[model samples]
Target: MTRPFPDDDSATLAAHLRRQAEEHRAKYVRAQSDRADKFVTSPRRVYELIRAGIRRGTMPHDQTLSEQHLIESLGATRNAVRKALQMLAEDGVLVRARRAGTSVVHDIVAVHDGEVGPRAWAGTPDEGRLTVDTLEISRISAPAVLQRLLGADTDSVLLLEQLGRMGGQPLYLRVGYCMTDATAEEFSQLIESNHTEFPPISVVHERLFGSAYGGSDYVVEAISCQERAAELLDMPVGAPVLLRELITRNSAGAPSELSYTHFRADRVAIVGSTLATTAASP
Candidate 1:
């Protein structure tokens, strides 16, 4: 006698599995789209809206969105959106809570990026108005990583770390290195004279070298905050941070300065402007 096989509706079973998988995928897409809608207009506009919402208590205190949300909302590429958020966060416009999400910071803080020229600091003299206080200036041996920026022998380059503040809060931590003894001596003297204020480093370079420092040939990358950076910025270790490596050259194109700047990611926003218009004569 042949053994009888139990009824197995293989086609129906496969159809059921396929339907479940599709349902799961649709749910994921909807969730992702909703998250992206929360933060994806122009990045600055998104931030401003969030700030306004927070002030009005419209945005729930416990609910927050991520940079990915902003990217998806704006329909921008991930890298572009991430860069914008990182810059804004570094400038202190948004608070990135650990494992929670990014939120608008209630406090007032601003980072001003100005060209190095005669009128760079014009119309800004008061403490909070300018946000230009020098926090620390110390001579230390250059770290191997920083040595590469200086393009000088690691054993010879002098490292100077300057911490800056705005409204009595840390703003940026900069590590500047130089091989020129004159530049080092002048910087030391300048730091001594202005114990409370920070003139733009580019301005100082111009005064010493007889010309403005050239645009940096360097890179800016994102990294997790280190212990020291976290402490200085009043954030937790492993917080998101911005790392800028700048190599400045003199008039003759010789490497004159190497600097690395780390910016706090919850108290500032870096604003850039561009002009666009429709042509009337086309």
Candidate 2:
């Protein structure tokens, strides 16, 4: 044995052995990954779990979720918890501030039946709810936002401005914009007829496109009331208002209408629903 290994240098042998060890270790790591697919959960799934808990009211609003708590409870790594919290904060689901523990913000409303916008505003005829007054309907130059949102090739868009009221007091202002279509005029009439009814836009979609209701995405943000919005909503120009943007699509997956509604904080409460498992923040 000594005679056979006499020519082999120790450094050379060590390098060869190290290389083989690395190769085997790499193979073992890959094999572990393949075998652990069923056992390992992704960061995204952890995020969904937390979000669903918040939306479903399992996690109380304003309740802080600590990293250590989540790690111990969910069997998640520090990196996964951090990423999930970051995403939720970005989506306005959680408030993450310096020195402040992450907490849920919105009050989850179980909207089991209809879109929040139409349903919240719609009241029974006998209930003496808010009245919607159509202020103006005009054709205007398409804003960049509208063009991008609606995928509109034209430069013009139809705008409908309305004010919601209760007992002669202005409650909220709704400004609706739609991509130009041949049926716009007729649709406009229908909207005008039911402006006060708080009819869901789905009805309009069905009449205009001859298709069923698709769906909508809503964004809720705090905005300072501008002069136009202030006047329409009958609030001070600098007052804070809840701005809800509704982006509704057609059956063909094309954006059909966009609505910017300014709600008085004291007058209305917006309610939204979530799925049993997960919900994307507005």
Candidate 3:
């Protein structure tokens, strides 16, 4: 039964109907585009995308992740979503409780093969803000292992300990052994400034020599925490962690600095890549 409206009322009703129709059409078009985008991606790409998100700090620590949300936002299939979640869980980046669903315990790390300078890839703008707090800086005898690596007397190396936080949450514990002639006092300003790669090892190199480091070699593996690391990282002793042992090389290809960084397995994600030289995004 259609009740005839006054002329003015009819005009308003028609305009409202038109707006509703346009909105519906726009929503359908957007859904179709999202579907198309999802259909063209591979399973591997889905895994990488999830990893990329974690690296970009979008998947925050301890945040419950919804499978349906991931599927919808990523335009991925059910199987693809399940597979990605399983892989992440196995990688220690996520955990699934009995009814709580999957939750993030990982953050992203970009592994470009050089100093912490301009690199092949930059993360999306949402990447976590890392604040480094220098705990102790002392001119101490090098650890036995570092003494052998440095091939110099133990008395010369400077020890710098730091703790990294992302948005006030603990991220990593770093112990840097700098093979520089700079005094412990000289490194205070640099390390506290939180620049120069969590420790000013490179700055000392540049201040003494005229150029930057040649490169760095990283040996990464899964390890169980020891006393010091367990205490600072707030993890149980023998808890599994991702250990990155880095040796920074001078331009002459000689190792001048060494650092042991223990990253929280469930609170950090490491994404490594090689890039060809090209103009970066504007």
Q: Which candidate tops lDDT? A: 3
Give lDDT tens digits, candidate 1, residues 1-282: 642333486777678779999999999999988866653435565546555444344544444556566555456556655555565567556557677767655443334433111112434422333334344444566678666656656555556676666556666777767655554566677655444343565666665455666655656578899998789777789987767666778656777667777766554444335589888995
Supply candidate 1's per-residue lDDT for 65. 53
Ranking by lDDT: 3, 2, 1
Per-residue lDDT for 71 in model 2? 73
lDDT of 3 by residue, 1-282 (tens): 665566669887898889999999999999988777656245676788888788776887678888888888888887888888888887777887878789886555543343331121225342335666788888877667668876556566778788876656666888878877777887676554534333333564565434676777887799999998888888889998878888887888876677888887766555558769988999
Worst 10 residues of 3 by lDDT: 113-122
Residue 8, candidate 1: C-alpha displacement in angstroms: 33
**How much RMSD separates candidate 3 from the native structure?**
15.6
Q: What is the TM-score of each candidate against the true structure?
A: 0.51, 0.51, 0.60
What are the lDDT scores of the predictions, listed in order? Answer: 0.58, 0.69, 0.71
Model 3, C-alpha of 102: deviation from truth (Å):
6.8
Best-to-worst order by TM-score is: 3, 2, 1
